[model samples]
Target: MRYYFVLTIFSCVFAYEKDLTFSVQAGKTDCFYHKVLPNEVIDLEYQVIDATHGELDISFQLADPVGRIIVADYKKSENAHRHTAALNGDYRFCFDNTFSTFSQKTVFFDLMIDTEENQDKEYDEDKEMEFGANSAESYMMRMRDISESVSRVRDNVSTARRLQELHSAHEARDRNRAEEMCAKVMTWSMVQIVLMMTVGATQVFFLKSLFEDRGSSSYKKLIPGLGSQ
Candidate 1:
């Protein structure tokens, strides 16, 4: 009985979840498709993390099996969408960078498919088998209470994982921006330093030239009496 309980918990904990990171080159479109069954729930979240030209925006679209657009966004930095499958077929989603001529976009996305009904049905069937030998009413009630608690914990874990992934992606995007800004500032500072050094050197040379005579003949050209001395 204990072994069966552990197995059930493991099954519930390991649900269907996929996380991916990819790059979409400039003036190109990348697409993916997943097969889903009717009544299954699909959750999608995506963020543009980094870009070559510092433009953190991309076009996104989700289409149903019949070529109907169910969710669409234009030049968005980050967005999420949730939908329930109505038909059994391949659903397509795409990331478009066609609007960018020279920038490549790096994107992070999460996809989750939830079949709560089927999970519940399987749990119920297992519960009946586990309790069939022992018909005590109070015992069955107690087991059901435990099952509910476990289900709640499973849901909380899933939510927490999703939130953690989103936070990580946000941190990465911010870090990239900070690094780019730092590089620009450093480059400008170096250029200013070089210009200041060059100007100072020119001023010093000019001041020295005023006090030193190049030759007696040259000095005599400026002062009429210098050649006689």
Candidate 2:
């Protein structure tokens, strides 16, 4: 009986991981719909990586249960927003790449729902420990210990995710800088090649002119009286 109760408590606090990885075409908007109940906490995190152009960010918006836009960001590469549902209905998160005429983007996002039901369960457990007739004090204390461990796990996961995102942003910046440098080097090399070819052709023409006979002298000798002068 004690073992089963512990299992139930652990299950109540465990959170599910939900994520999406997809591409949005140019000049289009893609949206994710989630149904949430009143007073539930919504935690959302997302990052957009521009695949085609440098610093090509995107826009996003969050709508409430009544379809009123609440959170909005423009030209953002990465952002996160969290809000509690005020009423029960569908919540919308949208990614807008419509500003880009020909460039598509890759987006990654995570959505987590933290319900009040979990809090209620924990409250009930505390009440049971305080006033129950046959509750083992050791079991109750163990349950609290396990709950604290779960909270720590959640915090560690959040920290790790943020660190990974920062690293990704750094990498993207470096990659863009490298590509720009390469393009400039290639253009400069082509210009040098063209200049060298032009100079070489000019030198060949000057050398040919210096070596050729005046042909004017031959023309004068062909006319009989012109040679005597």
Candidate 3:
């Protein structure tokens, strides 16, 4: 029991570490990258100060981890309002210069990421790395391309393992909930059955007493009166 408790605690801590946060100085009002997980929500707070004293209106376009653009908005937006991440990878936050075309401007932003059920994916990643080592040299060469691509694949595998662990945990929780519900239903059914039986038994006894009383009354009425005799 103690070992189980310890393992559970460690798992929780490991999960907490999967969520990421990053802050970048105002470098460009063009594009930024944030790695997030599937089904997770990321909060992006961008503060662009007009250093050049230029009136700049900017909008952001969100990209999936595969560099695919998802959400595009030309209108100004405040801190990301509970924005849900579409995929489990690095998402791009693209800022567009709508009004002013300054030579070069700086934009600052903070990304707050919360991964969803990711700890399970890391297991798959470790196993993949072990397998990757034995692959042909050609395969390894392909893996090394773009440097960023390799990193992306690694991250994806990690996400997969984290998700696997979380999936099992979720199943266990569901089973526990189902068991509790079943027990409650059984207790309630038993109570109802006992109450019904008690009520039926009482009714039968009352009916028997009524019948006996009626018979005795009839006998008294039929008996001859002693004074008249």
Which pairs of residues clash in candidate 2, taking residues 3 or more apart in a chain or in different chains?
A: none
TM-score result, candidate 3? 0.37
> Which RMSD values do the candidates have, in order?
5.2, 6.2, 21.9
lDDT of 3 by residue, 1-229 (tens): 3353233323422322232222222434556665676666665555333324333235677778777766666645233434776667777777665455442333444455644235335433543664666655464344334333534565587567555544554454456456766888999999999999999997886676667766354444546563354
Better of 1 and 2 by TM-score: 1
Compute the lDDT of residue 139 as modeled in candidate 1: 61
Instruction: List residue ranges in candidate 2 displaced over 4 A.
Output: 116-135, 169-173, 180-184, 214-229
Model 2 TM: 0.75
In candidate 3, stretches whose alpha carbon ends up further than 4 angstroms from where it belongs are 1-29, 66-68, 75-77, 116-229
lDDT of 2 by residue, 153-188 (tens): 866886687567657755765676688679989999
The C-alpha local distance difference test score for the whole of candidate 2 amounts to 0.75
What are the Cα lDDT values of the candidates? 0.86, 0.75, 0.52
Task: Provide the TM-score for each candidate, comma-separated.
Answer: 0.82, 0.75, 0.37
RMSD of 2: 6.2
Question: Weakest 10 consecutive residues, lDDT, candidate 2?
Answer: 215-224
